[model samples]
Target: MFSLLSSTFGISRPLILKPQTWRIFSSTHVNHALPMDPERRKKLDERNERRRFRIAHDPEYQAKQDEDKKQRRLRYASDPQYREKLLEFGHIWNTRKSQDPEYVEACNASIRARQRSFDKLRVRLQAENPRYRLRKSLHQWCLKHDWVRETLPWKTHQPVLFASKVHKECKGCTRVKVREGVKLWWRKIGDRDESWLCHACHMPMDNHTAAMPYGYEDVTTMEGIINRKQELERTAKG
Candidate 1:
């Protein structure tokens, strides 16, 4: 790897062969010579429990931990190498955990319980909050459209409709599609403007078109609007 980097970046071999570089590299290859004695393991567990208690009860320590976590997340996002390494480690860890059926079952049960609680809370919020009700209704209306539904990808983690592919942001509201489904409309043929329109922005235009608000001699329906959008998308792609 060093030789490849040297060849690619034109770094001198002597620089990589320095004593300081060797010392740093060797330091990372520490051997676990100490055996896990029962007493030592018990002491370590007690120390970890104390640390956890301190983190939970101490405001200063908690704040420091939160800051440290934020910094780690920022670094993970900005540093591709670090992100890749972390992902690789996580994949390996998950793979090992998944090999145990009992562990997998426990994880699945916990996830299901959390999802049920979240769903109940969401339903209650929708019933109580007028704003939430309107937002959720608008979002549901958008999902009834074929084009918008197709854009969402399936996920193994969450079992919900339109639960995946949240990267697209709506042009009108700047909200992601995953929060509420979005409609990507192509205004005309041969023009490819990836303008994402969330339900809140799309509904008014849809209503206006259906109402023939401009007094034009044209009739429009929800199906007609969806069909037109799909046709325009195909034309733009072609």
Candidate 2:
């Protein structure tokens, strides 16, 4: 084996194994290691890039699009099973797509394009959505909400979603259980009850700008944190 390698490289096996020797001659010897035509590679890369650009820009191919549409229309119009299959496929596709950034950005852009002028009445009408009422920062919402105070007390360590017949599991991220020690959010001596969040989600929540209303300067530091806690306690008492 050693003699064959030495004969092939015209160098000692030790020299061939040496990293420095490989680095020194890598530019010349790399083709032997991974032989491929540079021009061919360049052409392939260009072709792939063009394909990606076309896919991103064009929703459907111009040549086959009409025929494809015709087939789909005929299938839907003629076959109930085809229509049902399409509906099921679309539901699943949209379910996945809702989480996609590109889809979300496109939806946002389309909504903004058709956005009506925000009058007071329009604002009030939009605000009628129950979601807006619960849009407060986690801390503020947890602190003020009676639902958390009385029902879901801060001292409760294992904060879990109610397991009814339909839902037999926690609604948290279904990722692998990396650690047994999930971040059990509690109302600390100076805090209100926050929901039990996984370590990954909890970290981002704590560090995020949206989490802190007045800014981290008020509650980030030890001294500031203490002051804020005392203020919260006072408010609770008052």
Candidate 3:
């Protein structure tokens, strides 16, 4: 009858009694089969408990997990491509407002106000101190030189101011060399006048002797230096 039923249903007879099914049938037929080893089961349960405890109590693992989440959040927030895409979307959304005249005017006005305030402060500071004024003048001279170079391509001859004294072993030998000379003439460049050195440093082989005025004392303190510099500036101006 089973063979007839299998042939009618087109089913393989061997598949109906597969190995797993046969094992179940045999176990059912034989009662009181040996149960799983209690020791092995207990060992498996202990291993699972240890795994759970390790996951719950490991401080380093918890810290690493937290660090990963923090880095992920930072990457998402600071990704340039993501920000650019967002900006592109915003541009599309505010196509008309992007070109609005009122917004541009407001931005320009804020910038101009900031520039004016900065200029006023700069002027006041330069007027308050001689050193500040000298520095401002030097900066203006450099800017004017740059502007002149830009406007006149062939004007390669530039008037450079140099210091009068040269140092032999000083760290600023190059600077001293560049600054050697006296200010024969003064001219305003941008915001201040340029000054030239009154004397030039003698070359190492040259017979030039260091000249110090009789009874001259060296200034050491910052205040003394400032006073001396002011006196020098006054003399130069005269």
TM-score (all chains, Cα) for each model? 0.30, 0.26, 0.28
lDDT of 3 by residue, 1-238 (tens): 2223222222121212322232211111211111124464455446546645765799886676668757755764789775455445434423433365664454456558778999999888768864444434433443445432232211212333324333223221345444452332222224343322222221112322111111112432335534665676688699
Note the clash tally of each candidate: 0, 0, 11
Pairs in clash, predicted candidate 2: none
lDDT of 2 by residue, 171-219 (tens): 3455455233332232223326443443234333333433332323234
Better of 1 and 3 by TM-score: 1
Tens-digit per-residue lDDT, 1-238, candidate 1:
4333222222221112323233212212211111124465455446556767988899998898778777877896799997666555444444554466764555466558778999999888768964444445435534565544344221111111343444445445655443454233212223365444444454343332321212221323455545656665687799
Instruction: Arrange candidates by lDDT, descending.
Output: 1, 2, 3
Clashes of 2: 0
Candidate 1 has what TM-score?
0.30
